[model samples]
Target: MNITISLKRRCEHVTEGTDEAGSGSLLNRIYTELYITEGQSEEVNTQHEKHIRVVLTNGVAGVGKTFSVQKFTLDWAEGLENQDVSLLILFSFRELNLIKDEQYSLLMLLHVFHPTLQKVTAEQLAVCKLLFIFDGLDESRLSLDFYNREVLSDVTQKSSVNVLLTNLIKGNLLPSALVWITSRPAAANQIPPEYVDRLTEVQGFTDAQKEEYFRRRFSDEDLSSRIISHIKTSRTLHIMCQIPVFCWITATVLDHMLTTDQRGELPKTLTDLYSHFLLVQTKRKKQKYDEGHETSPQELMEADREVLLKLGRLAFEHLEKGNIMFYQEDLEQCGLDVTEASVYSGVCTEIFKRECVIFQKTVYCFVHLSIQEFLAAVYMFHCYTNKNTKVLEDFQEKDWRYSRYSSDSSLDNFLRRAMQKSLKSENGHLDLFVRFLHGLSLETNQRLLRGLLGQTDNSPEIIQRAINNLKEMNSDKISPERSINVFHCLTEINDHSVHQEIQEFLKSENKIREETL
Candidate 1:
């Protein structure tokens, strides 16, 4: 693809855009929305009978691993199930967190399969047949190797290190059925031996693929050719083109930017791409607002951490008085109203969709764990000067960088009503609150909480609460939210765990350490 198209053509037709705050939004929607790209899905159907069991899907962050797993699961259910057999149990390892053992993870999987398990203990699960899709091995905090297979005689005879040594240390954890794992190459060590033999990697779209997808999106051959050239040639855009989201970002950029073809340098870093991309997008969105568009969304804004915190704070403050999922009317109760607010909201939501920040269907969430980390970093650096005050209200395991999109007006309205109506109350709204919390990740949480605690308003209370939660969360009663949050709060900024933004945060501290240490 050439890099010399009009910016509008470059920016059009993205599935969604990427955001640092919007994590988990993309994968959650993948299997449910959009067709699985052919490059990845072609080989999936042939594996229905390979008694070998356990499949693994590998790719970079935004490639189609999770989506493929989901599509496979759905297809498997439609074909593989006979009258006696039923239900596939998919476990996202990202949801499992730093659980102590493969057995522990199995135990958790058992619980999800609990309703299906007639009388099986986690130990008894061996006899019971089921399917497992363990997603996100690379993103997990603990590193376990999976490439080579090994034998495990007994899991009960060892120490903590043995438990962590998954490749050589199998226990009652191995199931008697089908399973799959997904991850990127960088985090390959996190996968255990159980998955190595079953590994599958996602190769990016081919040039013909780009032509097919782009042409479907826009009819003009010359325009599609221009976009294809940019996708093939632009170095930074080239990286994104490898991932589906970047393809969408490319298309969206082509569609809107009037900057015309100035031979400006492309973004060198992911953040550079996002920042430049968002700037051009914000310009186009402002145009829609200027034209005087309105909707039923009560209030919407180009919700960043600042805007979300402001709105969520008021919502939380009001909800602290109770438990509810606030709606348009509830927004009014929170002393928030006016339709003009989310004008940026609806359009900004599209920003998330085009870039693949979240699912482009009815319910969406942040696309990656990194997005929330970035948002938390941004909030700590700029929004709240106080080191302890949390920037969000009613958070949970999955929050939206973008939720699913609906092309139908009625369906869109229905989902919005469902979301808004869900928010009308408090405690019952716990799920609603967490719907967005899904946007945060362990690594991101670890970076944001440990790194930014000093600059927060309620750092002491937050830290203590997290530690206390840790005390309560053991192998027996692990809380997903509790476990991940504790890991987030306790994990120091390990230099080994450096992200692109770490150096920026380290600069001020390095100066002080230079004088002291």
Candidate 2:
């Protein structure tokens, strides 16, 4: 069924500048454009049915792909949107992956995941219009052998998890089922193009929507306005604000900084932004602890630093294994007591969330994939600069331009090592970490990270070396997205000369990087 819904307009400060008479109509059009059909409905016969059976919604990390799907399903379930879509079954690939090793028929799979469905007969399910929402295909570890899997028509047929999914999507099993799969752009290829009837991207918020989000997030009008102005002033930060998660992070960080009378410049780069946020959270936690006890400020700061380091280590290690969620043992492995880790709810809790898994088991994961990557970079920086004192001492005395033969204390060696580690992953898994590593070499970002690390010398030189290493790497072999990420890494350095060099390099090579840049 073709579904369309109109939303009521809510008068607000951001919309005050627009035509008041046209606001209601504009809201109607927006909702219609967001959910209305863009193509003609396909024909159906006794044996065949068609109408965009498979819809693939793609987005980058933290762009709200899963949230959009959730909202859509919830609205449908509430009879507020897409009322014709009955039986909306939502499954996250993260949870689905846990059962990839287990053998189960499609009927059993549904029974195990949704027990209520067991009461419905197969004939009833076939007749009704069902929407299956599969979220986070990027997190799936199942080997989906779509090309090789044989078609199975029976729901009671047993097969590998991938085979079941492939057959279900291919119309061999439950052909009438309408499937909506949400994934990061990188993993959209797991399902071949032939299977997808419609592809849409969740582009996060628009400029006006961003303003609305800020107003809703911060109750203080003056503070929210200041933040809006601050974000508008910085091009890089403003561009990143297009993402919903980044907007939340900005609002949270600026709220604390503005009220506390921060003296330094606001964060312009991603690393600078996250570093400031981390420092603010740690300091806030320390202050709370200091108020109750006679603990010294230094001692509190030391404890906070230790907690952050342990969390960072956990983030880095689990990220390498492609694990966003962990168990109690994982916390213990990071030298963190469960109670101590739980107390980190204020500072790092956003990064590490505790949730119940199957069988009443509890699991912890970074709130978002990018958070894990960001903390991984922070861990790498902490390891080379703070934990290892010799590296900081050598940075002060050594001529880092030349390679060191004596030890790994050389900043150049450390920078090269970081690049190597990040570049080894072809999936571009380490793209953010690589970008943040370059950003960490900037003096401004280092200043923000100072509470967790020692003072640095010749950070600009290290940044230059890292940039050179990036340039030496083959970009043509990787996706254009990675190349754009490389450009973003250059911008994170926040150096005019480096920007100019990038412009020259692009000009000489006859290449135009991302238009947004």
Candidate 3:
């Protein structure tokens, strides 16, 4: 769980020559030098540091941001570091969302969450040096209206949770207290730059760290070496290993495949890997909960098909709206009951996670965003195979020509429309979803997911059509960032023509440059 973290100062704006090659750049250089690793020391080392009142940390989903926050809190509680502060209050946005509508004075709020503090008077709280850690701003449901909200400077004054949070962050309430906020990159801007004294990022793992992660995970040296070597062979897998969660997924999958007698080539493509992962989880669920009966992979999946599809529906609907966190109501909306949802976490802990933030109110989310995308794709494909035209029509609203009743609803046409829809997205959030959709089209993946997907048209012509559609996709209109995904889709389908052509083109260009030199 230990990963590398890089700390840097927040820059309002970047311009050429601002820190260009001079002693003036020393300030920026000092920030870059601050790297923290859990294995090294409990203390964070910094040079030429100033008093940091409010810090904002941003990292991608599943990049160990929450882990770092937990470690910091644990270290503080154990008196391993930062003993100067009298009190440290850790508030995750997920838990805070439960009481977002309630009004409480700063003192009352503290007393409610920490009952031990109920006896502490407001006068005593005002003088105590405190640090407030707000984690997962991306999952917040509260309206943090910092600009227009009325501010109360008194600790005894009652107000909405939003107001209290804004006022505290703005230094209007308890200005002497230190504040630390963590969020995904997209949601980091929620806290205005003026309120942040420093910015840090959880960079996940370095190359050396990735190797160490596998070595530590597996007790068998040979197994760990094989896992590391296999990961290195796949460029996509190696790059994804940089994210700690993805590394765990990779380890889980490879370990299951290598240790078991199941006969097949190691999964190279994302779709193939996930397909195996699903099967592995199902098998584990059976062994753990179902009297240890031996069941075929398909039967294992069939046993959990209904609940998995419900979860998939939840993943697909929320993924469209860019929501990763889900409430109990959200789960019910997708036809998933509390008992059914718990089965997922109880069995496949890494695939789905449920956290009891406070008051026994649980919050749920897929372990990683990519898994959500994968499940969403699975759900979408299931809809297609069942001819659930209502779902398809809702997804493909712009394409009036392709109706639910239309006879031309082939895999190629369906996937092409999905590609077009994903490209239209401004932030490319749907890029991975679309890639997973295309990946699911492969006959190999279809067979692997046959239990959940039901009967599919796995004819050679149908599969070829889907592959050809991806290869001939027009990329000129889209940004290069999104365009690269088309090639990834092609890779998923095991079509390497585009990749080989690119390699040849690069080689020829290099040869021409060599001749000119």
Off by over 4 Å in 1: 1-55, 80-87, 98-108, 111-125, 141-171, 192-195, 219-223, 258-272, 280-285, 288-365, 368-517
Q: Write the per-residue lDDT of candidate 3 for residues 1-517, one digit (tens) a residue.
A: 1101111111212211112111132222212111233221122323213777888887777777766776666556656778898888777888888999988898888777665566778777689899998999988888888796597899899999999999998889998899999988667767877667777788878888888878876889999999999999997788778787788788878998787676768888888888887877776766532233343656767877887898899999998887888998998898888775454542345467676756888888886788899999999999988988788888875554555466568777888888878878776778888888877888777777788886666567877888777766644767887778888888787778888999999999999999999
- Output the number of the TM-score-best candidate: 3
RMSD for each model, in Å, please? 18.6, 8.8, 10.2
Candidate 2: tens digits of C-alpha lDDT, residues 1-517:
1121211111111111112112222222222112222331232111232467888787777776755664565456446788787677777787777778888888877777765566666667778888887888877878888797488888888988888899888888899898888888667778887677877778778888788778876788998999999999887878888887788778878887788645657777788888766656566555542233333323444656777777778887877676666678888999988876343555665455665545566666676676777777777777676545553343323443322344555555566565555556666777787778777777666655655655555455666776676666636775676667767777776644556776799886665455435
Candidate 2: 10-residue stretch with minimal lDDT: 7-16
Candidate 3 wrongly placed segments (more than 4 Å) = 1-51, 287-295, 339-350, 399-408, 458-477, 501-517
List the candidate numbers ranked by lDDT, top first.
Answer: 3, 2, 1
Whichever of 1 and 3 has more lDDT, that candidate is: 3
Determine the backbone clash count of candidate 3: 0
User: How much is the lDDT of residue 328 in candidate 1?
Assistant: 41
lDDT per residue for candidate 1 within 1-517, as digits (tens), equals 1111221122222234434224343222332233232222333334334555555566765676755665555444445323233445555543443243434333433444333443445444445565555677654544454333544433233333224345332323453555566766555545444334445568766655656667765666777777777556644456446666566656666644323542334433333344334444444445431222232011112333344343444444433343112234544553434354552363345432222111121212234333332333333233223422233213311242222232221222222322333333332323222222221212333222332222222344443443343334323444454334323322321111223345667887899999998
lDDT of each: 0.40, 0.67, 0.75
